[model samples]
Target: MAVVSVQQVSKIYGHRLSLVNALNNISFEIKSGEFVGIMGPSGAGKTTLLNMIATIDQPTHGRVLIKNQVVSRMREARLANFRRHELGFIFQDFNLLDSLTVRENILLPLALDKFSVAMIEQRLAQVSRVLGIGNLLARYPDEISIGQRQRVACGRAMITKPTLLLADEPTGSLDSKSATELLQYLTVINRQEKATILLVTHDAFTASYCRRILFIRDGQLFSEIIRNGNRQQFFNQIIDMQATIGGGGRYNAITPGH
Candidate 1:
């Protein structure tokens, strides 16, 4: 079954006098256990689309369904509950609390839901082992390396075993080595845990990690490329596509405003 379904969704901003269509009739479905990427040039509405899927923003038209539940029309209270129970988010900056230990951070979501202490501990162990952060659970966020911190963040996101994981530029702040490490961890989790992920990134290197990529242009679905064999070939194809779409260059070249 599809874990996420976005149908004919559009997001508009500004008044009638100065209206902007950040997203224009976007539609897509991500099935279970699929790792997908949304790629685009700056101002192409990649993040806008991601926000709508995350339920952080609502579309001006059409519907967004997660597990067949129409989230676009959900009340605020129900939406908050749905977000807590069904969704996981990984941000580019590791949004960890300095005051909390790695273990505590990973258990925060369960605590909010009032899960039993024993249940939280079991999930903590499982997710930490999956992300290879089992050894760092006792450490504070400031004490761990950037790569380990990202792993801790991943652990927290997976502790809930969420239906869909939404990642926004998850590797944007890391060095090349650290970024590669985190991507490998993400791949492991996707394959082993059967987690469905939809990642938003402008970098070809990042998009290459996905099984399939959707390129957005001018707030519309432009094209899609699926990985057939090796990742190196997929990375090369992404680079070529970026070049064709005027999104080529170093990572800095494709910043928010380019």
Candidate 2:
């Protein structure tokens, strides 16, 4: 089943005098339990497309459907409620509250929804275990390593059991080791928990973790590649595609095992 459907979506900025089309009639579907990646050059509208699907921005033309419900036309009031319940986000920077402990940070979403204390604790335990951060629950964000902090962020995003998890440049700041670890954790979540994820990154190494990738350029999807064999092969394929599409000018170099 298709969990997300973006149909003929176009996003335009400004008016007639100085108009910009950030996205141009892009259409795609992400099936349930699929791990997908969106990649492109610096000005290829990757973030703009992500924002539209995240419901943070509206499309100038066409509709976005999450589980068959039209989101582009939703009212602001209802949209807030829908976003809170159905979508989860992981940012490049760990967005955990400084004053809150790891446990409290992971439980924030459920707490906002007025979930009982018992229920919140139960959900927190499960997510913390899954992300291998059970030991860091009592520590402050500053007390943990960068990798652990990102795991906490992932735990928080998954506690709500959102229909879709949207990650934007999630590994952009981490070192190679930490980035690989986080990607492994995401793979485990996708396989074991059946969480549908859509990640946006310019790095081919990061995109290699996804089962499928969509490459965009100049406000349109230029091409796509699926992982047919080992991850190293997939990574090479992504590099080649990026070269063919004239991307990856600013992307970091990556090795086979790194």
Candidate 3:
């Protein structure tokens, strides 16, 4: 099933002189339970596309559908509900509240919906266990390592049981080991939980973790590669493709490499 559909999407800014086409005639379909990555250079509209899918931004001349529902046309209030119920997000900055403990941070989603204390506890235990943050529940964000904080962010995003997970540079702030571990966790989550994932990343290594990838350039869809055979080979292909796109590693700077 197609969990997300973007058809001829375009986003324009300014009048004409200083106008910017953030995204231009972009189209794609993301199927359920698939791990997909969006890659591109600095001005390639990766974050723009992710924001459109997250319902935080709307396109100028196209429609974005989530589960066959037109999200862009939904009212703001309804969109908020849709976001709360259908989408999960992990940002580069972690976005966890400094004042809240890891457990409390993970419980924010359910609490917003008025979930009972018992239910919240059950969810906290389940999600933390899945993300391997079960023992850090009592610690505040300042008390844990960057990796642990990112995992807590993951737990918070997943605690809501969202149908689709949208991750933006999730491993950008971690060490190489932490980044690899977090990527592995994401792969496991996708496979074990059957969660559809749309990740915006520029790192070939990170994209290798995805089952498929969509490359963008100059505000348009450029190419795609599927990882049906070997993951290591796929990683190499991504690197070569980025080089082919003619940027001195600037492509990596636009997404995960940040």
Top candidate (TM-score): 2
Could you give candidate 3's per-residue lDDT for residues 10-93 as a string of tens digits?
A: 999789789899999999999999999999887789999998999999999999999999998999999999999899999899
Model 3 residue pairs with clashes? none
Q: Each candidate: RMSD to true structure?
A: 3.4, 1.5, 3.0
lDDT of 2 by residue, 158-177 (tens): 99999999999999989888
TM-score of model 2 (CA atoms): 0.97
Which candidate number maximizes lDDT?
2
lDDT of 2 at 71: 90
The residue pairs found clashing in candidate 1 are none
Model 1 clash number:
0
* Global CA lDDT computed for model 1: 0.90
| Pick by TM-score: 1 or 3, better one | 1
Question: What TM-score would you give candidate 3 relative to the actual structure?
Answer: 0.93
Clashes of each: 0, 0, 0
Tens digits of per-residue lDDT for model 1, 31-71: 99999999988999999999999999999998999999999
* Model 1 worst lDDT window (10 residues): 249-258
lDDT of each: 0.90, 0.92, 0.88
